[model samples]
Target: MKNFRREGNSNPVPAPSGGVVAGDGVLVGSLFGIAAIDAAEGESVEIASVGVFEMKKTSAQAWTVGAKVYWDGTNKVATTTASGNSLIGVAVGAAANPSATGLVRLNGVSI
Candidate 1:
């Protein structure tokens, strides 16, 4: 139940997703990914939101996530995603040219 509020915003409101039953009041984090890169090139490693305050490397492929996402749950049961990937860490990729940004979306809730 750790909520990271953006700078200047002290509300620390809970970001819950709608339509997805697997998520609720849980927690979430920003979804970021590289864009514009060719599929033939070596892609960035995949990322997954491990709970609400940590991220883990789960794949060796590229992935994307909403920018608004900013929360993750507190259970390791659902450590990584099935297929899609989510960046839940503070370290961005070090590729020569990464997407840099993606749609900002909330996490914890389904999206």
Candidate 2:
């Protein structure tokens, strides 16, 4: 049976989805190279939404691989610097298989 659309019959608005897709994460790696951003704030960012934290290398530091991080961006506790990219992000994991039933950001325009 065809669903009914009452009202003035305007085009249906599309749902939000297909945000930044999380890649097969490293156990304890840096998120700095997670995704190169041309700019911050206005850019569309996505995380596990619920899982381990995704950490990114902030300074000239090298962290061990296979470690879980919450992609809290750089300088999370502090503000971003003009020279480096210290933007905060989210952490992701496999409790929800972001691939099988992966996570995605809704309302791309909203973000």
Candidate 3:
């Protein structure tokens, strides 16, 4: 374990412009995570890099169980559209179109 480091389930990163609220999905550089707490812009915030989270999704899009999901940073929602979006995780449960939220399992790795 000479090269061991802390487990990366969560990580501390500077909040992006406009800050972040608790439970907000965040993309810092290439890392994607959910904010563990509210933090001001440029302040350090602990982001959960792995685990299942109920998050906002594109209300017009329907999601099926096990479908890959991407993070739409600008709109701040989970989406099935791949182009221009960052891969965040997969849908763990079916989400009906027009629903406000969806269940997602974090992949713990950047796209």
Give me the runs in candidate 3 sitting further than 4 Å from their true place: none
| Clash pairs (backbone) in predicted model 3 | none
TM-score of 2: 0.19
lDDT of 1 at 61: 26
Global CA lDDT computed for model 2 = 0.25
Q: To one decimal, what is the Cα RMSD in angstroms of model 2 from the true structure?
A: 13.9
Worst 10 residues of 1 by lDDT: 32-41
Q: CA shift at 3, candidate 3, in angstroms? A: 2.6
True-structure RMSD, every candidate? 15.7, 13.9, 0.8
Per-residue lDDT tens digits for candidate 3, residues 4-102, read 899999999999999999999989988899999999999999999899999999999899999999999899998999999999999999999899999
Candidates sorted by lDDT, best first = 3, 1, 2
TM-score of each: 0.19, 0.19, 0.96
Clashes of each: 22, 16, 0
Q: Model 1, stretches more than 4 Å misplaced?
A: 1-52, 65-106
Q: Give the C-alpha miss distance for residue 10 in model 2, angstroms.
A: 28
Cα deviation of 98 in candidate 2 (Å)? 30
